[model samples]
Target: MAVYKVYAPPAPPTGGAASPEHFVFVRESFSWAAFLIPLPWMLYRRLWIVLAFYCLAAVAMALLAGSELAPVSMALGVLTPFVLGFEGNALRGWSLDRRGYTLEGVAEGRRRDDAEIRFFTRWVGGHAAAPQQPTPGPAARTLPITTLRETPTGIVGLFPTAGTQT
Candidate 1:
């Protein structure tokens, strides 16, 4: 099979409450190879400059905003790309099926709401399904990973969404 897109249905029971639930169709990226293929080209194009600027901005915002607001500043700075990278290029989900695994890429113009983030859940246990061969299209779309942990809702990222306010 060519691995188009693999997704497992969300858990059926919510503590046996028997309420309605939504299936989260997660689409992980292909591989580092996908990025690696363009690594040399990116370096040649001085893409590092963008990364450097992002780091510099993060630090500047953190310092100027103070620890309390620094995280917010840093988040907003990073989120700009998600909001404006592609069209609205926002990665909807991530996958750990392939040998290298992959995360979704931002859409081509789908902007995110500036409202305070309530929460986000990226993956769920025993429910993670492998995408079909070949993967899905470049478009960013997925079902939704609602039950990521034992908890009903949570967000996944470089850092877990625990201990953070909405």
Candidate 2:
């Protein structure tokens, strides 16, 4: 996997005090679904517990007007914000913004203490298009490996030069 270290401005210090700190940001990869799916399932699981209220509403609506409207209203009530929240989480690739390092990427699960987030991203043309550069820090270093693989739970590294043909 390729890791680039880029500088970022830190957030304002807490307690209305200023402190000197340097931070770096890195990018992890994700597919489009990284922000979709999972919403309906999570919502559906929670919705089951409220089935009683839905039953009552259905009967009430039937007596006042018609049963059809109850299902529609109930569906909307359960789905609207749930979908919104899920989409928000998916699109917002998980990140760790801290004293001096930031990692942004999509991962199936997170390790404790936000130590690492596993995610997958692909490089075009099956390889980097141009020569890469070493990031400046305490020392400059080159990435000996290139491709990072994604599993349902996290990332697994494969040989940098060993990936499917683009």
Lowest-sum lDDT 10-residue window in model 1: 111-120
Q: Per-residue lDDT for 32-126 in model 1, tens only?
A: 32233333432443345444555676578768676677667878766644432331101222222222223322111122221101111322343
What is each predicted model's overall lDDT from 0 to 1? 0.37, 0.38
lDDT of 1: 0.37
State how far residue 99 of model 1 sits from its true place (Å).
Answer: 35
Candidate 2 stretches with Cα past 4 Å from truth are: 1-69, 91-110, 117-166
Candidates in order, TM-scores: namely 0.21, 0.22
Tens-digit per-residue lDDT, 1-166, candidate 2: 4333233344455643222232223333332232344345335434332334445654665564445466766666566445435443322322223233233222233331132222222222222133357669967677565344443333344543344334
How many clashes does the backbone of model 1 have? 28
